[model samples]
Target: MAILTRAGRIELANAIKQKSIYLAWGQGAIEWDTQLPSEPSSSTELTSILGYRKATRVLYCDADEQGEIQVPNGRYKIVAGPTPHLYCQFNYDFNDGLSKSIRELGLMVGTKPKASTPSGQLYFQPEDIEQKGTLLLLEHRPAIYRDQGVRESFEFVISF
Candidate 1:
């Protein structure tokens, strides 16, 4: 749950200077996965399918609620896309005795979301984020998006 600790501020500062960061979305219960990086390290990685989905996107680190380089905490919003991305769709129904259901949403961060082998990935860094992925900031949260076709907007807030 801790993105940047007191000791990781230096790395966080360097990461903040990057033009963009990778955002990986997934489905699961509303809880922190053990795979999430408690702190940036060489071995942090994501494994479970419930906590990981292939549909990933590159996002700008533009915090709307605060400045771009807000230290203690920085917020980044993923503007709603035109169409729903994978693992981001939602459907609900109350017909059969309250059958309303939704896919849990989780967020993770990395240097890049390359779809290639570990070694072939761009901006690959083990400590920052290896091919396996890193920084699971958000655990699954049930979002009620009745229109599955419409893209959903998401926000990521990280504090150092």
Candidate 2:
């Protein structure tokens, strides 16, 4: 048997923190309720991505939710705990995926910009990018219908 050291885990967590990360949402399939397959860890992309956007924030912290917090600067003290973990947050625009039934979401890493991509654009439609990046995380669930004037937010905690 083999065990990875805590220092190794912290290094891995820091490596991921330095990369470009995005949260991608997809419509998936209409029959997802009855047919969505088990989430394959090897999946490179969502079944049908409507759009994606960069993470709003990323945090490096320890297991007890200590060592790091994204509160207003100087508002709280920081403490590095024993175990390492990452917290990522994303916010979607009201018009994104509007009138669509979204049933899948993924966390992407290392997505690349396309030749025609405009400068400083954060949100992206599928056709706007080159590579979709490695699919670092995947989720499939019951459909959530998007309506006008309604926005969405997603948060994920990844422990290494």
Candidate 3:
């Protein structure tokens, strides 16, 4: 997968400065969705980095839990599977040491997984415009182990 280039990082910084929410899907070749409700136009730098053209398809969905946000003028469903961790990426400028603060806060609230259980890590690259910033949002889920005598279930974030 191609990581966000320097120019792409710059564009992301600008988007954040403008308070625009940039949406991308996929572990590789992210498809940029619609501009945030507050932003007016898409980021050219971001599009270039993604190798997007006029013909490329962008899928948009609501940021809310109800999936009220829409692009292409329709409603859609989001699905997810059970995992030990939930990962997220953000296109924002993390300057003024704000990113560090956020990371610290997350670490404090986040639970540590058992050494015997499998663990997951979410990676994020913050825009360059931000000073010493990389946004890595991680949601850790506790591991469950059971034998034939017991049944176990897991919780996941899904949109439907």
Candidate 4:
């Protein structure tokens, strides 16, 4: 196998980072346990698009807790998972930034279903929407790296 240099890895990582939708349990919570708004999120109580990607701490990814990517939905911009993000810590794990598993609940990443379909966008489980539990303190951040981390701001998308 070929080895990636630090710069190469960052470039590759950044390139792959875009085209993805991400969610982290934010400092707020949704207490009603409701279904995700299948309609345009504008009409729902989804959190505003501000303060996303502000978590400067390094996020920890794991083997067991990887994302469940799904096929393309005519609905969302990027299609992926419908997994229930039932849990995640309210604050960033500031210890070492190299934790094996994340403190956040479920993490959704990977491809939308199809041949040659792209990967990395997140998806919501229709059943998990409005299930009547506390809302996960969610921070929806999409990683769209224009210059691979040198862009003005990181691009995040709530849907898809």
Q: What is the C-alpha lDDT of each candidate?
A: 0.35, 0.79, 0.24, 0.27
Question: Would you estimate the TM-scores of all the predictions?
Answer: 0.36, 0.84, 0.16, 0.21
In terms of lDDT, which candidate is stronger, 1 or 2?
2
Task: Rank candidates by lDDT, best first.
Answer: 2, 1, 4, 3
15-110 in candidate 2: lDDT tens per residue? 888899999999988889787778987788898899888899877644332433443221222234333567778988888888999999999988
- Inter-residue clash pairs, candidate 3: 62-69, 95-131
C-alpha RMSD by candidate, in order: 11.8, 5.1, 18.8, 18.6
Clashing residue pairs, backbone N/CA/C < 3 A, model 2: 67-79
Best by TM-score: 2
lDDT of 3 by residue, 26-140 (tens): 1111122222222123322221111100101112122343553332334333324222122122322222222121111111112222244333322223321122222212221
TM-score for predicted model 3 compared with the true structure: 0.16
lDDT string, candidate 4, 19-105, tens digits: 332232221223323323232323222332211122222222211323332212212122232221111112322231222222222
Off by over 4 Å in 1: 1-11, 16-20, 29-103, 111-130, 143-146
Question: Could you give me the TM-score of model 2 versus the true structure?
Answer: 0.84
Per-residue lDDT value at 43 in model 3: 20
Query: Candidate 1: minimum summed lDDT over ten consecutive residues — where?
Result: 83-92
Q: How far in Å is the alpha carbon of 125 misplaced in model 1?
A: 22
Model 2, which residues run further than 4 Å from truth? Answer: 34-36, 65-83
Cα lDDT of model 1 by residue, 1-160, tens digit: 6564544653553454242344433333334333333423442433233212332333334345654333334434444321111122112122211222223333444434444446533222223333444454434434343344444444444433
